[model samples]
Target: MQRVRVSSQQAAVHKLGDSQMTLSPKFRLPAARSTITDHALDFDNSLTGEPLIPGFPDDVALQCLLRVPVDQHTSCKSVCKRWYSLFGSKERFFTLRKVLGFHDPWLFVFAYHKCTGKIEWKVLDLTHLSWHTIPAMPCKDKVCPQGFRCVSIPHEGALFVCGGVVSDVDCPLNLVLKYEARKNRWTVMKKMVTARSFFASGVINGMIYVAGGNSTDLYELDSCEMMDPKNGSWSPVSNMRTHMASYDSAVLDGKFLVTEGWFWPFYVVPRGQIYDPMTDNWENMPAGLREGWTGSSVVIHGNLFVVTEHERTKLKVYDSGNDCWEVVEGPPLPENICKPFRVNCWESRVYVVGRNLHVAVGYVVENYEIATGGNGKKGGRFCVRWETVDAPGSLFDLTPSSAQVLFA
Candidate 1:
């Protein structure tokens, strides 16, 4: 096992360098939906302050251009220098799209070269169900990463990759790579105060929270850290309740919930905790909910959903109010199929990527209840419906994270 270590300087934000926050004047006022079709902004790109497009008004032209699908954005960018500058600005493009109600959700899967083992990310367009390539992660030797952890910032078109192993030698790194959805590129971000692997991370309210990973040995560290994207700086988060590695994590009710691990044990023991940013403190997780969070999890409709690690046969949800695991009983997996290679959830839908790159999108068919024998009462049950499609290729082994859903 690889381990890394860094000191926890609480209540302190590291000043690595100057912030990379860039602002342009053109994107200042967002175009209102009421005037999306009727009018256009008078912003000028020419030397004499003339509107960008020759025939139509600039805002009207931009409104039409923004309606173009994201896959065709690069083609639009190549028309002229002004077009390139307008489309290339991640903030402007996404902002205009949001104003026009054209926000689309996509699934990002980080897969590796089947033969060479070179790691890269693929974007699955949920609208069209097509596969597309994203920019390669900036890793050492431009090869696959080690001890890597990724968290998606959905509102903004970006994903963050923190601390990964640099090479086969297990030389741990403190690198943070940021991926911009609009730009289709990856750029390095400010370093994490510490370099560690297998850490638990989540983004809440635009701030990135990371906790618990290894440092220098097999032991897990209790230290934590947070990053502010606005300033491109890293700050130390409050330490965890106990020094234990987290197997899976999800946010619930504005709190980051992490669970299922041990503190130097031979047998499996699930230790869980919750970190509330409002208070910047950790608390012990409830009993029943803590035990079964041993697999990949995502937050859907303000509830914690899990895809079991052993078989990925059934979908499970945790009812925090009652503190119990409720299984979504529907169709079982095919006899020939095994556990999924990756899983993610968005809104009411859950997506699973099978070993052969078979994609199954599951959603609740209807709401009903099963008759429980106790006290003449009924229990909650979900009838999940599945839709399957084949993606481009098979996933490589040693993937650190599963697929993530993003709205761009």
Candidate 2:
């Protein structure tokens, strides 16, 4: 039997015994679709009379577009003027995604090339387990990794890369760059009032705060400031009791905690501070809390957890009532996930990015209890389930400096 080739237009034609009918042109597939470049040329056209998707209601079309993978958002925005307007505005697009339950959690890794010391960002789509690169940051000067502080307003789909040092000149920079996930674009925001490096920064009540970092002369800075993301304006905040650069930091219970981690040689105890937004003041961290904060930290469900930086890399949760750290009931950190890692969490899951971009995810359960004996003796325990994912070979040369989770 011979097969007949039907043109797209003819494919829409139907026969009904004695009668023949053709579907509406809107229902027919075009033989050749317009290229993105062609659509881009009409970007300036007004969307006042244009439908988001042809032959469909704007609301239905919006729902369809909301389901599109975030990686393809740029291409979708280039499809038409109305789409560009929707995808380019964070308030409209991200707000809709949040309201409609279409946003997804993504892991953003700030990594640097070990050989060249060049810094870049990579994003992991948690839902699909895929990786993609974001646009290059606006910094023109050479900079070092781990010298800047990154913070985000996850629900707003925004990430901010704050102050850092210029590697070539050994100068601190106040440059602030904002990445809008919805549009997949970067905007250079207002610079911080103080140039700093290796600072402690966190978001509280939609405001970004930075404190206790190195200044231009490599002197530890005790000065602090807060930025209202809405206006991109910075204002002075109360200074820390002492000048200390952050070795690890977290925002828990609506406050920012910064610790100058323990140093080798066992000389002196490290210092830590907690900043309360409501009071706009800083308080000394509890002795037990700071003394045992031995590694990077991430807050989950209002509880503070840490992955130890020492050998074996144990997981621990802070017992605030006792002001001490308790071991989490879970397997040790994956052998493949080595030291020099970065940690971040969302909801009950913890993400640790180790050398070579290897990731280990820990699902945590708090306040669990285990029965010890027939006498009914029970011990309170925190449990974690571990899972690991390997990095692509292309990312093997990159080492993570920071990791953040954003919803988009």
Question: Which residue runs does candidate 2 get wrong by more than 4 Å?
Answer: 1-101, 369-379
Error of 1 at 183 (Å): 2.5
Writing each residue's lDDT as its tens digit, candidate 1 over 302-356 gives 7777766653477777877688888876665443334535778777888876554
Candidate 2 structure quality by residue, lDDT tens digits, 213-295: 99999999999899999999999999999998999888899998999998765589999999998988899999999999989
RMSD of each: 13.0, 9.7
lDDT score for candidate 2 against the true structure: 0.81
In candidate 1, position 245 carries an lDDT of: 63
lDDT of each: 0.68, 0.81
Output the number of the lDDT-best candidate.
2
Runs with alpha carbons beyond 4 Å of true place in candidate 1: 1-99, 142-146, 261-266, 333-340, 369-379, 393-400
What does candidate 1 score in Cα RMSD to the true structure? 13.0
Cα displacement (Å) at residue 234, model 1: 1.3
TM-score for each candidate, following the candidate numbering: 0.74, 0.78
